[model samples]
Target: MGKRILVVDDEKLIVKGIRFSLEQEGMEVDCAYDGEEALMYAKENEYDLILLDVMLPKHDGFEVCQTIREYSDVPIIMLTAKGDDMDKILGLEYGADDYITKPFNILEVKARMKAIMRRMNKREQTKEEKTLVKGDMTIDRDSRRVFIAEKEMNLTAKEFDLLELLAANPNKVYSRENLLNLVWGYEYPGDARTVDVHIRRLREKIEKNPSEPKYVHTKWGVGYYFRG
Candidate 1:
């Protein structure tokens, strides 16, 4: 069966365009013209992915995204107008899988959609192979689940990638640049602080003591290492 996608946007034309593009790739598409309707549909149905617009009537995409995250982990890719970095960051911080600026190429949207879908699908495949236990922490690669004792941990895509990378190689010191390339799958621009933020977040979720992290350790002047 084709993968299912829910496209939520206030713009009818944009919805049609996205639906057309996605359906061409053999995906099943559903559309919602407002945030309230989108949230309703999302709550009642299961989708492999959700394409959500930032601006909407009634509830707004950010609120919808935030609400959905409370109950589901379905991947969400937010759509926003250009120069809306704050919106993008807010979406990401609230658990969005990705964001695309308006006036975006249909091809770029399709590419990102496919990439996000690939990552989500990959996590399913690896869910079974992941079995790295460190003290109270358990990293299950198959379901892409991380657990501290019996409590499940919620991690962003990048955070999960970082943990998987370090846990898979135990005691290996990977520099920020290396981690950026490995975990993010690209050469990150600007300072390597992106890695730092993710690590900090990860520590908060999985560490018994964030100030004195056990699984992930900083090698001052170097980068980070996982103590197996």
Candidate 2:
């Protein structure tokens, strides 16, 4: 079966354009015009990807993304009419997998969708082949599981992605922008604080002391590196 995608936008034209474009790429697409209906459809169906609009009746994309994160790890790409950086940053912080600005090229949108789907599919394909071990921590890429001293650690999807990226290349210092682009799969318009927050949260879960994180170390102004 082809991949299923959910398109949520209040604008009828936008929804139609996206549905048509994605369908041409051999994807099954569904649509909702508001956040309320979008949430309903999401609850009743399992989608491979969700294209969510930032401005919607009832809830808005940020809230919808946050609510969806409560129960699903399904990838989300937020759409916004505004070009404001804050809007994009908020969308990411709320768990959006990516964001598209208004007046976007349908081709670009399709390209981004294809890129994200390809990366996700590749991760699944190599799940069994990639495993990272550092000190007492073990990250199994196939199962998407992290363990500390054989005990499982609960990590958010984004947190796990960050750790995986860092661990995949141990001791390689990655700048904040690079991490955001590589792991987040989008250009983050906000300050580096988003990376800091996720890093802190990850440390609390994996480190014996969050203040003295051992696995993920900062290189002052350079960025972060995984100490394997």
Candidate 3:
């Protein structure tokens, strides 16, 4: 089945270009011009991915992303202004799977989208139907869901991937750069801080106290590991 994607932006020209490029790839594309309309589309359809602009009328991309996250873990990539580091970080904090700066090449955008979908597909194809139990947390590999103390936790796509990797490995430490390559894809053009933000968010969700995390641990100068 061809991937279904929703492209949200205030700029009609940008949306037109992206929709054209993605449609040429044989994927189904839906376009929305503002955050409210984007949210409406998201609630009604199941999309493989979403390309959301940071600046939009009504709620804006960050708000839209956060609202969708309340019910879905669909992969979302934010489009931010060039050199806007805050926008990128904010996007991740709000549950975005990734981000691309403005003035981006359509080729690069396609590559990023494909990479995320590829990883998701590989995971679904290869993982066995089993659960990983560590302390109070439970990871359902087959369904890509995590639960703590029997209550289901809301984890984003990247968060689930990162947690599954670490929980499966026990105490194996992974450097920020190594994790970025492994979890986000080797071709991903992101800094180590991206890993940091995801880690913090994961810790907040699963840990009893995020300030002193029990499941995900920092290795001081090295990186992070899951203490099974």
Question: Which candidate comes out best when scored by lDDT?
Answer: 3
lDDT of 3 by residue, 8-65 (tens): 9999999999999999999999999998999999999999999999899998999999
**What are the RMSDs of all candidates, in order?**
3.0, 2.3, 2.4
Query: Total clashing residue pairs per candidate?
Result: 7, 1, 0
Q: Model 2, poorest ten-residue lDDT window?
A: 122-131
Clash pairs for candidate 3: none
As a whole number from 0 to 100, the lDDT of residue 7 in candidate 1 is 98
Candidate 2 on 1-228: residue-level lDDT in tens?
Answer: 889999999999889988998888889999999999999999999999999999899989898898897778788999889978877777887778888888899999888888888877876776554778887888988667899899999887888889988988889999998888888776765567788878898899988988898899999999999987
lDDT for each candidate structure: 0.82, 0.87, 0.88
Per-residue error (Å), model 1, residue 152? 4.7
Question: What is the Cα-based lDDT of residue 126 in candidate 1?
Answer: 61
Tell me each candidate's TM-score: 0.80, 0.87, 0.87
lDDT of 1: 0.82
Candidate 2's displacement at residue 19, Å, is 1.5
Q: How many backbone clashes are present in model 2?
A: 1
- Name the lDDT value of residue 129 in candidate 2: 47
